[model samples]
Every structure is written in C-alpha cells, then in structure tokens.
Target chain A: MDAMPKWADVVLIPLISLILAAILSALVILAIGESPTKALMLMIDGALGSTYGWGYTLYYATNFIFTGLAVSIAFHARMFNIGGEGQAMIGGLGVALVCLFIPWPHWSLALLGGTIAAALFGAAWAAIPAFLQAKRGSHIVITTIMFNFIAAALLNYLLIGALKPKGSMEPATGKFPEATHLPNMHEVLAPFGIEFSKAAPANISFFVAILACFAVWALIWRTKLGYEIRAFGHSESAAKYAGISPTKIIMVSMLISGGLAGMMAINNVQGEAERLVLNAVEGAGFIGIAVALMGRSHPFGVFLAAILFGFLYQGGAELALWTKIPREMIVVIQALVILFTGALDNMVRMPLERMFLAAKRRNKGAA
Target chain B: MELLTILQVLDSTMRLATPLLLACLAGLYSERAGIFDIGLEGKMLAAAFLSAAVAYTTGSAWIGLLAGIAASLGLSAIHGLASITFRGNQLISGVAINFLAAGLTVVVSQSWFGQGGRTPQLAGSARFEPITLPFAEALRDIPVLGPIYYELISGHTALVYIALLLVPVTWWVLYSTRFGLRMRAVGENPAAVDTAGVSVVGLRYAAVIICGVLCGIAGAYLATALQAGFVKDMSAGRGYIALAALIFAKWRPWYALYACLLFGFLQALALRPDVIEGVLGFKVNGQLLDVLPYILTVIILAGFVGKAIPPRAGGEPYVKER
Candidate 1:
C-alpha cells in the first residue's frame, strides 16, 4: 500500500515541484528588477496565443520529444546516458551526409535515408560506452560523459576540415538541396482547409515524434525486452538469477536510446535548418535529462514535459525580445526545474506522503 | 624535438596541470567520504566567474580568491542539502548544479557587467603575475638543469606551487591522520564508522566542504592566474577530465598527481600541433590530441589497461539500518 494514490504520485508531485520552481524563478526575476506577473503574461501570450507562436513552440517540442524519449529509454534500464548531446550532434552529421550525398529525387525518400543514417550513427557513438560498461564494470555515467567530449572534438575536426563547403567562411555545410525540403505546417494543413503560419519551422517531424512517443510506450509496457530491462534496473543480481543478461539489456537499450536521440536531427537539422551548422544541437540534448526526470521516464509524460519545455524555449526568446531579461534566463529556470524535480524530489514527497497518510487515518477513524 | 622546445612544453604542462590537479584533489576528498560529486566543474565554474567578477571590480586577486571559495562553498552546501540531508540522487544533484552554475554565472555577469556575459580584462594587481623564484637569474647560466629549473619550475604564478604542494599534504592527511582514517572508513563502510560512534554526516559534510574549497582555488587559478579574466565556459571540460583523472589514479593521491600531469602534457601538446608534425614527420589533428584523455580514460575504464575500481560505497547514500 502506498501513502499517496497513483494520480497524486504522477500529477500532484510534479505540479507542486513545478510551482516551487516557478516561485523561485519569480524571485530571480524580482532580483533582476523585473515584474514576474508581466513576464508570465508575456510567456503565455508568446507561446500559446496563436498559430504562429504554436508553430515555434511545437517545433522546439519536436526536438525535445526525440531526446526525451532517448533519455527515458536509457533511464528505464537504469543507465545514465548523458551523452545525448554528442549523439545528436553526430546524428546531425548523418542527416547532412544523407541529404548532401544521396541526391534524393523526393523529400520523402530523403527523409527515409536521413532517419536510417541518423539512427545508425547515433547508435554507433553510444555502442562504445555501452560495451565498456557491460564488459568491464566501467561506470556508465563517467564513460558516457567522456564520450560527449570526444564526440565534440571529433565533430569540431570534421567541421573545420571535410564538412565545410568550399570557400565558405562558416564552419558549416552548404545549404541542402531543395529536393530534400520537408513540408512545414502551412503546407501540410493547407490541403485540409486549415491555416498555419508559413514562416514556422514545425514540420512533418512533429507527427513522427508523436508516433515515437506511442512506440516507446508500447516498447516499455508490452515487450519482453522492456521487462528484462526493468528487471535489470531493479536489481542486477535478481535479474541475473531470473535469466536476464545484463549485457544484452544494456547494449540494446542504449543503442535504442542513442538512435532516438540521433533521430532528433530530422526536426532540427533536416526539417528546420536545412543545412548542418556547427551548433545544431544547441543544448537540446542536455535538456533531455530535465525532461525525462520531470516526466518520470514515461512516454506520454515525456510528451507533455517536452511541450512544456518547448513553451519555455519559445517564451524565453519572447521574454528576451520584449524585456531587458537575457536569453539565459531560461537556463536558470531549467536548472531550478531539474534541481526540484530530480534532486530535491523527496523534499516535496516526504511531506506530501505524511499528509496523505494522516488524512487516510482520519477517514479510517471516522468509519 | 629540440631541448628548448621540449622545455617549453614541459613548462606549459606544469601550468596546465595545476587546475586539473586541484580539481582532481577536490573530487578525491568528496568521493573519498562516499559523496560522489560530478559537479566539480560547476563549482569551479561558479568560483571562476565570481573570482573574476570580484577581482575586476575590486582590483585585488587575494580578495577574489576568498570570494571564489565562498561561492563554491555555497554550491557545496546545496549539494549537501539535496544528497546528504534529503538522500536524493547524487548524480542528479550534480547535474543540476552544473546547469545552475552554467546559467546563473552568465545571467549575473550580463546583469552586472553588461559586456555580453564577460568581465573586463583584469590588469595591474587584479591578476596573478608569474613570479621569478629567488636566484633564478643566477641559476639560469649553469646548465640544462639550470635552464629547466629557472624556466620551467620558477616562472609559474604562486597558485601552481600551492597546487603542487597540496599533493603531498593530501597524501599525508589521508594516510597519517585519525580523521583521515575515519573519512576513509565512512566511504567504505559507514556502518562501521557509525557503530564506532563517529558522526557519518559530519565527516561527509567536512569532506564536501573541503572539496568545495579546493575547487574554489582551482577556479581562481584558472581565471586570475592562468588567464587575465573569466570567459564564459572558460573552464571548458576540465572538470570532467579531472573526474576521469580521479578514476585513472585509482583514488590514490600520488597517482592523481601523475595522472593530472600526463593529461596536462597531452593538452599542452595538443595546443602546439606543429611540434608533433616537426618531430614525428606527419601531420596530426589537434582535436585528436584534445580527445586523447577521454579515449584513454575509456580504455582504462574498460580494463584493457589496469582496472580502475572506485571505493565500494562511492555513489550510494549511506542509510542507517536501525
């Protein structure tokens, strides 16, 4: 028997944590001499007021969905895969290569090629750390963190050398060919007698991200592999006794996690940028950690959390534009969110559980 | 390579190794007491920014060092609140601290200085100038040994020597003292320490606070001694590399010094790509050298080299069974 009901565990806790984070963020704004109420109004208006704002919000959400699902998959296996940033960077490289070299005759075909390439490249980057962790008892957290730096260095070298376009001053590939352009919201909604902002970057990848959420849901709750992964996570010794191979679970889940993280490229690099730049990932990979923690590593929960972060990203930009607040304000808010939801969770949970238990005892006495 | 060229690289190696050594020792103290800290980078970053910001404003590097230590101590207290008092996820707490420092430093800098999140270039007494050891000029004409001593060992800021000095002090404290024994026991078997009537929480907090102080010094060295002022994310990934060095050293103080120096040498070599090409007759990418520490750490971790085992109670929060 639990002290609190399931709904409260899932919904109430997160709400309280979010409220705490918001209160602190408000204090921060006040410290900077800004009006928290005005900031809140502006955030809501810029992020959810109209189709134009929704487009940008959803576009950022697409990136978070892939990365969040990626982190969530690894979390289920009890593996801390902090290298999502590097994997996404390499995934962008894969997208760039597929689009630039394949010369696809149609956008659909190019999307297919890009997806496969991104997943494979991302999986390859994750494989080394996974292998080391499984075979040698190496700490996955440390190994993955190391991989992030190595991947960055590798990407830097490539950007400066082979990846840069001829005579280009920027350390980025040339603009992708027109044939590989993904359809934005405006084009997709027009045939249905609906309107969307044409300037918005939200594209077909948004649907793919939704599909991924469902797929991840099924994979975690309805598969033998998922069971084994969770079993290993709960108790490695017990899982071994139950005939589950830790190595297989570790390798499979990390590869999938890396693949999902890599697949974020479809939205950012292929769908939005249309050309691979040096900073394509833009810290969205690290944002996955906060999302997975807040969502409790559930796919549907991740979907909601991703959107929340998307709103924060777009609204933060709006705040920067309309007020004196700097763009890094969003990062401060993110830190508070992660701190409250992930690290100090018990700070909320302990008190909530006691209150619920007290209320339950009162009802029993009354009965 | 020529002797002069090699000497120069070694000199740079000493300078580069100081921060790694300081940060690695910070990790050693914290993890030794069973509190795993992945936030050394963040604490160092916060310290670096505060140290630079204060130094630039006040024009005294000494005051900057104190401010830096205070800043790092504040973050350490937060980590203690979350992981020690609340028994939350240590790694998660660490990640949060990293992000907090990364974000808060920039926001504060932008609000305070308004130079796009940067402090003004420190000058005069605000920065640590390289010191000329006594008799260095007199010793410079003796021989190869003289040049090496005068050029490589005598020209670093005082912080470098302080970092090197701490290595032996750390060894003596960890091996030769009663508090050191209790700290080590707390990390490996907190139950035993508890049964013996020592306060596990107190020892762990002390270790964490020590870690913070070392990290503060490391950041101060980076901004005030090595560079004129702080740049955003100027510590780069040195905190992570220092963590790697901790593992590579197998949690021993002397081995940590060696690991840091080797990693620092690699960084020094990476900065001079021409030296590799001139000596080895082939061009090598500086990025590869930049990545070598992480790669080598991975390989060592995989046990392809010697095994690097952490302390048994390293990442687990100690719980009283009663």
Candidate 2:
C-alpha cells in the first residue's frame, strides 16, 4: 500500500501544484484588477509567442536550472544552502579575474579555465561555513546569510575599485577578452533561417544546463554516495548508526552545492554577457530556493520548474511592455507560486496517498 | 590626545547602535518563544517606510512612530498566523514575508509617494530630535568621567534612550515575569509547555507580535531618526546583523544590547574613513573597513564567541494531541 502511494506521489504531486498555482494566480490577478484569462494569455504568449522570446526564455532558464540544481543538491542532504548568492558572486569574480588578467591563447581553454576557477572559488566560499557548521556547530542559515553580505561587499569593492571598466560609470568589471567569450551560436542558428537577435544571448549554456541536470540525477540516484546522502537526509541518527559521518557528509554536500552554484557564473560571464556587473546574479541564488521547492528537489523536476520560472520571468518583462503592470509583478508572482506550491504540498500529499493506498488494497484483494 | 577621539567615536557608536539594539531585543523575544523571527528585516522595512510616509503626511514624528509600530504589528500577525496556526516552515515563511515586504514596500512607496522607491524627505519637526541632558552638560566640566557621560549620554536620539531603558525592562520580563518564564519554556520544549497548561500558540503569537512592534520602532528610528527617509533595501541586512547580535549576546537582553552596540560601532567606524585613519594612524583600505562588520559576524559565529545555542524547539510549531 505504501509502495503504491509513494510511486503515485511522484506523478500526482506536481499536477496538484500546477492547479494550485493557477487558482492562486487567478486570485492574484483579480486582486490586482486584471482579468485572469487575459493576463495568463499574455503570460503564455510572452513566454512562447515568438522564436526570439523562446530563445531568451531558454537563455535565462539555463541559469535558473544550474542554480536550482545547486540548491536541490544541498536540500538532498537536508541542508539549506542560502550561500548560493555568495557562492555565485565569488565564482563570477573568479571567472572575471581569469578572463581579464590571465592570458589565454584559445577561447575554449579560457572558457574552461574560467568555469573551473569559478567552481573552485565557490567551493572555497562554501567550505568556510561548512567547516564552521561541522567544527563549531554554527547554524548554516545564519552563517550563509552573513557570507552573502560579505560577498556583496567584496564584489562591490572589487568591481568598483579593481575591475571597473574604463569610461563606464556603472559598477561593472571590464569586458572579457574576445577569446574568453563563448562562441555565439546565434549566427549558426541564423543560417537555418532562425533569426537570433543581439538581445537574445542564447548559447551553448542551455546544453550545459541539460547535461548538468543529467549529471545531478545520476549523482543522486545511481551512486553509493547518493545512497548515503539520501540515508543521511532521511535520518541523521540512522545514518550515523550505519557508520556514516554526519560532519563529512555535510561538508561534502555543501561543497558540491557551492561548486554547482559557481557554475552559474559560466552562463552569466561566458554565455550571456562578457562583463561582470553588480547584481549580476540579481537574486538568482535566492530565487533558486523557490525553484528547488517547486521542483520538489528532483533533477528533472528542477529542470521543468526552471523552464516554467524562466517563462514567467521573460513573459513578465514582455507583459510589462503591453500593460500598466510593472516588471516587479513577476517577483510577486514568483513568491505566490512558492507559497501555493508549499501549501499545496501538504494539502495534497495525504489525500493522494490515501487514494493510492485504497487502489492498491483493492487490486491486492482482487488478486 | 587620541584618547579623546576614541571617546568621541564611542559616543557616536551609542547613537548608531540604538536602532539595532531595539531590533535585536525584538528578535530575542520571538526566538525565546520558539518562533524564528527572520521577518525582523521585513518588519523593520515596513515600519521604516510607513513611519517616513506617515510622518511626512501628518507632520508629526510621534504619529509616525505609532504608525510604524502598527504597521510592523500587522506584518508580525501574518507571520504569527502562518507559523503558529498553519504550522508552516518558519524560515521559508519568514523569507517569503521578507521578500514580500521588500517588494511591496517599494511598490507602494513608488505608487503612493512617486518618490522613486522612497518616502518624502522628513523635516526636523517630523523627525526624532536628539535629547540633551543638563546634568551631562554640567558634568562635562569635570575630568574623564565627565567626558564619558557628556559624550556617551548627551545629545542622542530619543529612541536611543528608549533602547537603553529596554535593556533592564527586558531582563526583568525575561527573568522575573511569569509570562517570560512561560515563553522560555515554550522555546525550550513546546510539548512540555503545552502539558503545563500554557497555550504555546498563544504565547508564540504574543511574542512574535511584540517582536513586530519592537521592529517597527527600530524601523521608524532608521527612517525618521537615523536618516531622513527610506531608500530601497535601506535596512541593508541590518536585521540579520541584529540576529547575529542576538546570538553573540547569548540571547540575553543586556548582552544583546552590547552586541548591537559593538556592531553599530563597527558600522560607524566603517562609514568614517577619516576617523579610522586618524585612529589607526595609517592608511586603511576603505573597502576593507566596509566589509569589516560582516567578516566579524562570520568570525563571531564561527568560533569567536563560542557556541550560541538556540532553543531546542526553536523553529518547530506546536501541535497538541490528545
């Protein structure tokens, strides 16, 4: 009975969440004095209406996917990795430094070096709090939050003072050398009659994101380490009794989480833009939590959820152009999705489980 | 010669520390009742925006202060309901509330005031003026003690005085009052508190609401007293700093007060490069100074202050079963 219910949980849970999101969106649209039908139509059209729109959506979705996976990786170990913002910032800094200061003859080598540098920086940043939590028992939430502030200050200082581009008032680093940028695939797509605008900076990052999803899926599902991580997440005491070190597992989980977050810089620096700018992450790390939650902390779930979020983001911007609504409404909608999904998870879990159990029992009786 | 300059810095520190002190104390109450009040930042932001807006409209600082407290109380009520009644995850709910407040305050401020993410600038009459004490002025004629009193106690904002007064009051309430005992009990073990005939939900709600009120006042102080208006994200992670202070102070009110003051001093020191240069007698990178408090917070949390243990049942919601 339990086994059947657990199996059904995978399918039914997300369906219920979507329905709940729709109802919640309706209520929000009504409250804000908009027609729900028209608003949602606008949302769908803006997200998927044109080739360019879809490309832009996919471009942003790629970053969301990486960050979402980063967050989900930590959640698997029952850790709330709020350091995603800090990790991403530090990683971007590393990428920018490598691209600008280090001389690379080949674009591919520079890109690879920049991405690896970001991952290492992010890993080091996360390792501090992990060490604190493991060695000193400091709360991960508070420590990570503190690191976020430090990262912000550090990024601001570096951008403004050390890495500021010549003749620019904005707080941003110098552009990467031509060799460091990812080869733009937009032109390649154009030969096939796909019109890729400069505004749509879609590149190979989307493929990288998909590959990351598969990698994480395999890491969590196929490996012995994944089993230990799941076991630890289920019950720390049980895992401890089974000879797993909680401290080591926590440190490893946080390191991986941070490293994945660092990979986000590759999308931003190499794929999307050539410069390191302030607010480059732009709350992506924080929004990753909502994405992870909506995805139910699963790899494929995170992928689909990232695309959904990317749609809302691009669509929200487009909707702003057509309506009086501000772009910030997208943020409100995102928050609303998180609220509804979180609440619906509890509301639907038991009823669906009961229904699945009853069907399983009936089938067994007939057999 | 430099000793006097240090004293002046200390004086400036007290004034800078007042709002954070109030906020940390506010967080202390909620956390002691087993509710994670990460929404302190949101509460403060809402209060700051409302206070500034109301003060500008009404032309009364007192009214603005009251309005700020009322605004914060309303937000706290939402937090209390979600966490206590619905048994939601305290941290996530708090984050949602924070993000909501961050976006909502800016949206409303932009729409209502048209000031581009801020309230209108408040006049002196609509702001909390510093209070000057005659005794302290008279004492300044004396030696070192007189300088200490004159510098630290004189010409500070009214909220600073209120914050100082709250320390003993908080101690009294937390240690002596039956309500405080029950609140602590609920934090330590909600089940035990529930079995002891106390309503855990009610106590937690009350604690959170009080936290809201305190955060509101702190917010108002930021807008009306500390500065003159609200800016987008003006709280600027001060709420988290206050939470760090709460832990650093071991969750005790007086200790929390000191912790807030220390952080506030760091902030003031970071802001004034001239003073830092004068004191250190060398060139200091301005960015390093700016990042000092955050680095200190990380260090403190890591091991500097040793382990700051939270209540055993801190983030758990109470559910009564027969």
lDDT at A214, model 1: 93
Docking class of 1: high
TM-score of chain A of each: 0.98, 0.92
Against the true structure, what is model 2's DockQ?
A: 0.39
Q: Candidate 1's error at B215, in angstroms?
A: 0.6
Worst lDDT 10-window in candidate 2 chain B: B286-295
lDDT digits (tens) for residues B1-322 of candidate 1? 6888999999999999999999999999999999999999999999999999999989999899999999999999999989888888899899999988888888788778888787889998999889999999998998898898898989899899999999999999999999999999999999999999999999999999999999999999999999999888888999999999999998899999999999999999998888989999998888898889899999899998889988788888878885
* DockQ of predictions, in order shown: 0.82, 0.39
Per-residue lDDT tens digits for candidate 2, residues A207-234, read 7789889999999999988888888989
What is the C-alpha lDDT profile of model 1 across A1-367, one tens digit per residue?
9999999999999999999999988998888779999999999999899889999999999999999999999999998898899899999999999999888999999988988998899988899889988888899889989988888888888888898988988888889999999999899999999989999889999999999999999888899988888888889899999999999999999999999999999999999999988879999988999999899999999999999999999999999899877888898888888899999999999999999999999999999
Q: Alpha-carbon error at B87 in model 1, in Å?
A: 0.9
Output candidate 2 Cα RMSD: 3.3
